[model samples]
Target chain A: MTADPRDLVVRGLTKRYANGALANDRIDLHVHAGEVFGLLGPNGAGKTTLVKQIIGLLKPSAGSITLGREDFVANPDTARALCAYLPQGALPLSSFRLQEVVELVGRIRGGDAPAVRRRVDHLIAALELDEWRDTAGIELSGGTRRLAGFLMAAVWPAALVILDEPTNDVDPLRRRLLWRLIRQLAEDGSSVLLVTHNVLEAEQSVDRLAVIDKGRIVAMGTPSSLKAGDRQSLRLQLSLVPGVDPPAPPPFAHRPIRLGQRWHLGIDQSDAPEAIRWAQDRMAAGVAEEYVLGATTIEDLYIRLIGREDALDRAS
Target chain B: MNLFTRWLRSYGLMVTWELRSLRTVLPLAFVVQTMISSGLILGLGFLMHDITATQAQFLAVGVTVVSMITLGMVMAPQLIASQKQSGAYEYLLSLPVPRTTLIAAGLTVHSLIALPGAAVALLIAWLRYDIALSVSPIVIPAALLTLTTAASIGFALAHAIPNPMVTSLVTNVLIFVILFYAPINFPADRLPVWLASVHQVLPFGHSANLMRAGLTEGLASSVGVSFAVLGGWALASWSVTAWVVGRRA
Candidate 1:
């Protein structure tokens, strides 16, 4: 198949701030048309820097970013014209009513007035924000404001839609609606770049994802492909009693991760029974509050990847 | 659409957005501005028991200039700094509109908001002092230049400084300097010789001179020099603001 002109191709993209800090180090990635691509990384992992460059807010230190036949870095106007961005904070809507903000952005993005009004109306109804339509931004709740911001970006039709932490502060029901809207955007043939640290949500939403750590893509693949190595292992999670020290991992278990009162142990499938027995014994002894055995998830893989990078840095 | 049409459309939309966003605050801003301008005129009047006509004209026109300066130099910087702190400025930059249009829209809205207070101040000055002001067409360019220069400088300061708190502090200090220290309400001759020389280069004194020349004929000297100085400052400050706005990374 011929390459779609709307595909976002970034080759050897790098960004080094003036303070000699490297934010994005020779990153390369491709987001095909009509694809839901996730950039999953923890805060300060260069995800935002990458998005900023793509939207032409930051000049890349090196490499090229092309959306269709246009160069994004060299032609930032094209980037602005073709990309719809929902920045990762409360939008500056304090003085504006929700409906006004959405419709204004749509019109500014060059949508016909009536068409934009219709689109705004549709989105407001879809997200069930009609009650808050006339409410000023300052009066809206955080979740409602975020939903309005989403509508502002989604009201316009663009080749690429970049949403940074769009689900942040959103209620669960609205978040589900947002995810559906995101899927709808992709289905309508727009490339959707979902920049978020929520691995569980990204796993469910993205067609493919890249895990970034320390300004580099540590791993990139479909969710299942990235988790394939852990397929033979079961994640044994133990929630210990408060103030109790974590129990030691069994010989068959990999290094255990302690997060607050919870301990996650990776064990082979064959060793699941022994792991369960150990967990049960700990619970019986009151050392553990509860235990759950589940398949390895993308969050585990993300932590493992970041941990590996940390180890490599120490070695070097 | 052609580039011009596109720019005009974007400019119109941005102006609308800014006005709507400022709807609640605009009335309050107008009230505060009117109070400051009218208060200055009436309060300063009490200080001088026997004021001459020239001094009356000076204070009246001077306060009008101060009202214009306050919007651009004090309020604009504060607003922009707030927007920067809230990440709204960055969001605006990321939009699919020409950056110049945003600046233009801001200037337009601010001018609209400030002019009413200025006019009210002038009316109060006329009614209270009964000053015979010779209104001339030069007042138009003079007012425009003063507002634009002050706003450009404000925008430049806000954008150049990374910390919003610092920007706020600096603008507060600017308001203080403009109100008391600057040779705006009084003649430069009243200040020390060294300070008078300093006022020659600064835009504040020149802004007052321009307004005074337009409002009361024969009251302001060196009209040509005042125009040149204000224009130069406007150009320089606007250049800095444009660079900051258009810059990437």
Candidate 2:
């Protein structure tokens, strides 16, 4: 059966290298039109490889990709025509000025000259890239170059836009602006595949998401849905006073993850009152200085699903 | 658009992009290539006092052939490897243009940039050696074929070989062998029978032979075979390049 032109459908997608390392297993997912779908995963979680396959940069060892009523494997040019990709790092067009790189991609990706100029101007201003507009890509800061690359990826009218870690290396203020632009892109009816491990920000942004780990999707749903999946579970995080022997985390069903002076404990939602009661007892003893009890976050779900927190925690 | 028009547009875009980026360095690149290619001939002129007319002619034409060889065989791999290493290769692939159009445009840009060096070498040789240069109708076509064949071989190797570093070194080795060891600027009889036989099959020797035929009239003992060999080499090089560039790395 054919998929709608407004959707990107991947079925039984697998990428096994000649050395027999399965980078992507028999995975499947879909992103409908006008939705921002995030593929959240830790490093080496097969997110980039899956996107590369979808973009025709790598051939799937098995199964197929259906994008906009065409098989992406059979008709990749058509698939590419309907998509725009912002790869993982900075824009690679070092020979051109920042603005020129944007306009060049616009034209090459099928925009007319006049329209390209106007669109490039709008994106540059919107992204706060005016100061560095005349600078060559080789000379621009990494953050500025990433901003330009993100803007260029959004220039053309591709139904599906793929962004791999769009906010990486960007400063805090620019990162906020970037998230705003992504929401605007979705509002304009582009289906965005945002591949990132920035769970907190992405939790607020994506309409739905899939958590992939070790070539398999361990979890899939909207942030709310995934969080709701474990409605029985809630997170208990406490910031203890410095150098106080942090008590044995009161035996959480799943091990508590420690961050600096804080200990994050997961418990059944029904046990929240008791957990808070226990935390309150510790607070009275001046052990836990501050505390936060809330529903499980996309990050908590991430740490639980991937089962490898230290590396991803530090990276994200 | 038709295939021809589409390719022409792509060629225009690629060439324009190349020239725009290279505006400041184009002059210097051309001058350096010319000097690097012909600098040896100038040294030979200055150093060799008792050189005969045959030796001077050999030196003149040999420098011209070496210029094209260096441009095609050595320069192509180095430049392409640099582009690939810099992530520019993926950047170009992400564009809407077809691979063939890009490759054609790249070859065109490379050949155009490379011509001035060979031309300068020929001019310097013409003046330094007082050699009689021929205005043969076949000269330009033969030169184009020789340059394109050598360059295509280089482009093919750059994509095929797993290690770009080694490919670059090998091109240098090939250049040295052709210049000093092969009978490029010397008599074929001086080389061993086995070495001469090897040159008979390889296009490097035929490239110089064809150029020699165009420069002077009576040296064409096997002109037909030389043309065939160079043309075949060009065709084969392009075929291999198409194969390697089309595959995923």
Candidate 3:
């Protein structure tokens, strides 16, 4: 009945279709106040479904969603009154002029005509949507319209704001501005749920994150927390000559992943003492031309965790 | 604001948004509706050798009934289905407005569209057949009830079957029933007793009967039954639509 105003708690959340395919299984997550919580997953990982349930667009087969003090599923009015959602893909309000979409959301959510106007103007200027202000959503470029959708949700600040794949297809400059804007929204005390597949950007942007795969959270923690176990492992990234095989499996608690043409071998800290020597031997053997040794990062953790799950899935 | 006021605001806002978008295509929509609604009446006039004034008046009103039914039962469902395909349906549903309010606003716009088409048909009847329509206040309420009933059914169908292709097919089938099979253009007694009994319960025959009575004095045999049947359809369809719209995908 009483919960923190700037938080979302999802517990024992499960979604199983009538055909008996489990999309999400007992997923539990706690998004804290004033922090951007990233729900990172590949396609078909139930990230969208979970967000849909949280936004009251989809009903879960089990469990409850609590955003702030209200049960979002049981009391959508309160939940929506206190929260805003930006769905994935381009803006769906393509029929409306850019400014009209902004104003509609502003007025509907905020209910203060003048204040919403001011905020709409401010966000338009900040996100540089002034030029396309009169254009319909379909007329603007992809990034411009996407920014409009984001502004629609952010035009009136709320306790909890949910954005699904907010940065997909956006240019680097606008993505940066958008990230800054998201950070500002959280700093102003909005709990931001950023669901995305861009793991690299999420690793930097999220205060805390969860890695989901095949309908379950494989990993959940801050970027630093996810990397806590990785501290024992050193990342050995190397570009090997074509037609040449990868280096012999290193004697360490390690997992090697191929990213494009390069190979990255994650070696445990105990073996960290030998990873450089090991890389040196491979380099001298002419098996590698370029090599870099660094601390294991969030991407490493994500790959390692999901890699295990995928392997088990194949076996099953 | 109170709950009623909140719902009213949401309904008005939704209609405003939909109408604003519709402004660009209003001319085309008008042409299509006008052609379809009046074409049926005009074709009857041209094809028949010696159609009487009373018969012409009945045909004009029946054709208007056909237009309103097609707009609500055929057009509304297809439009909602298209919205679902374009992802705008989900976006609209996610808004804080009440679900019924959204449907009401949509029904209002579609029903409003039906009127102009009916007007064009009435104009054709006056200019061509010299039939004078009675100024009956009941016509307004009758059209509102009839359109709302049909629109609710269409909305229910849209949510029940969200696929655009399937919905289009279904709406086409419905249009055919309203145009040829239903008693909208003729008295239920003209059909076999079994079919007439079925039409007695259905809202379409009642719809045309109500419209005919409004346009011509003392023509409807049972206005009360017609109003009751149409009201029942409205309530039943509205219930189904509200239930289906909240269902999980």
Candidate 4:
């Protein structure tokens, strides 16, 4: 019987730098093919190190990385030929024009010059680098350079593409373009391993995510699945009738506001049913107004999984 | 494909780019230095009262050796140091290509830059000295040996220490010290015993001696031994350079 397509396996992946510090400690990861996997982490969570091992850049101290049963460590050249990596600090060669850089990398994929040229032109137009095709890398703006760097890797014919912070300096429009390109890649049956701290970006881009914290995976699942938490809350506001004082919200509610004789309640997602029943009872008691249910956003999950206070501290 | 062919392909590509870079930097220097050295050697020899064919040929060989040293010790190091600072080497390493190709390509370019100077020196020597120096069987091999040895030594030094200012200082000092013991325009008869003893071990003096022997007369056993010595130094330097670059990669 043939092996299944969902077959990336990493076991006991350990990496200790020469300075006696543990970067990755015996981590295990299994990523299915044709699926988008996001590596979410804080700045120094060893995300890049783990990605390096996966890309065959750095050797793990103790680990067995396999792609569909073939040993990646023992046959790195073959593994590398099958995958494309866009490193976090990737930059284009200053001497090469945008067209030249793209064409060169495309040629490395064993494509003929005409085919490579066609692909380069298509990518340039798709990425809106048409006007900058002849411009050197150093002369381009920071965001444009980043786009070029990303396109070079994405143009490869490899099965798996690993991108580190693809949208770091990209603006919203370019980010949309990049996402369209990524979705196209996934639709073409390629696996994309996205490493980024932009939870909002990852929220929309990845089919699934693995959140890493302090050199280990703290959580892993689809975006919706991971964000599905009991702590989800809805903020409901009720406008009181003329000349009537607003009533207090339930004990679970906090930050109740009285705006123009109105009442607001913060109720959890689970409490929504009971809270709605209570609201009906209050409405029968003549406390009247409309309310809004705020579904928990990915940003809220970001804070919950990491920590809100810690994020604020980091931002400060 | 075999490893050698793969490496050779990469080396050819890198060498082409390196030569393109040299066009802006040392190509002019090579032409000007060769002309100046050739003119000086011919003019000085012509001014001598009893300059014989052998002595003029000797002077030509001496000037050629000096030119090779200038290109190897000074120009090669400067070019490599600039490439490192410009992030060119890092760019090359980031490619799937081998590092040995990069070093070998650089050395090949260095040897190429030295060729014009040697050719000019030999032409002036043959013309002004009125010596019947042809492309002897020995001259081709001797020149190749000297070129290869200079390139390997220069490359090894550049790879070992890639700092532009430091490499310049060290190369100049090394060239000066090596010149003191080598037989250039000045006669080697007045040298001290200690210095003469040191000259026996140094490669420049031996290189000049071998080249002079090859052009003016047929190759003797002693010149053959000098050729062997130069070849040995070249082999060792190339080996060490490959090792260091491999380890760093």
Best by TM-score: 1
Q: Hey, what RMSD does candidate 3 come out at? A: 4.1
B95-183 in candidate 3: lDDT tens per residue? Answer: 77787777888888877877787788778767777877786888888888888888888887888885788999999998888987888
Q: Compose the digit string of candidate 2's lDDT tens values, residues B1-249.
A: 797887677677766666555555567777777886567787877777788888888788788888877777887787677667666566566666666766777677666677788888888888877987765877778788888888888888887776768877888798788787776676677789999998887887788887888787665468789899888888888888877666653
Local error of candidate 4 at A110, Å?
Answer: 2.7
Stretches of candidate 1 exceeding 4 Å from the true structure: A242-245, A308-316
- What is candidate 1's local distance difference test score? 0.88
Better by TM-score, candidate 4 or 2? 2
* C-alpha lDDT (0 to 100) for residue A180 of candidate 2: 84
> In DockQ, how does model 2 score against the reference complex?
0.38
Candidate 4, lDDT over the whole model: 0.70
Model 2: runs farther than 4 Å from truth? A1-3, A89-91, A229-234, A237-247, A252-255, A258-263, A267-295, A310-316, B20-28, B46-49, B217-221
lDDT at B216, model 4: 61
lDDT tens string, model 4, A1-316? 1334646778989888878778888788777677778988777889988877776666788888888767777765555667777777745356567787767666554456798898788888988879999987768877787788787777766677778888877777888998899888777777788888877778778888888877877788888887666346676656676766666677767555454555656577677787777777777788665555566555555555565323312110
Q: If ranked by DockQ, best first, what sequence of candidates would result? A: 1, 3, 2, 4
Model 2 has fnat of 0.25
TM-score per candidate, in order? 0.95, 0.89, 0.90, 0.67
- lDDT per residue for candidate 1 within A109-226, as digits (tens), equals 9899899999998898889888998998999999888888888889988999999988888888888898999999999999999998888888988999999988999999899999
The Cα local distance difference test for each model comes to 0.88, 0.79, 0.80, 0.70
Which CAPRI quality tier does the interface of model 3 achieve? acceptable
Report the C-alpha lDDT of model 4 over B96-204, residue by residue, as the tens digit: 4566767777777887688877777767766766765545577777777777788788778777874766877777787676545466654455578787677666667
lDDT comparison, 3 vs 4, better candidate:
3
Evaluate model 3: give its lDDT: 0.80
Leading candidate by DockQ: 1
> In candidate 4, residue A293 scores what lDDT?
53
lDDT of 2 by residue, A1-316 (tens): 2345778899999999888989899999988888899998888889999987887777789989887667888766666677788888434556678888778778767788999899888877777889998888778888888888888789877888999988888888888888888888887988899999888878888899998989998888888888886677888989999999887877554558776687878888677788988999999999999888988877887876766654254333
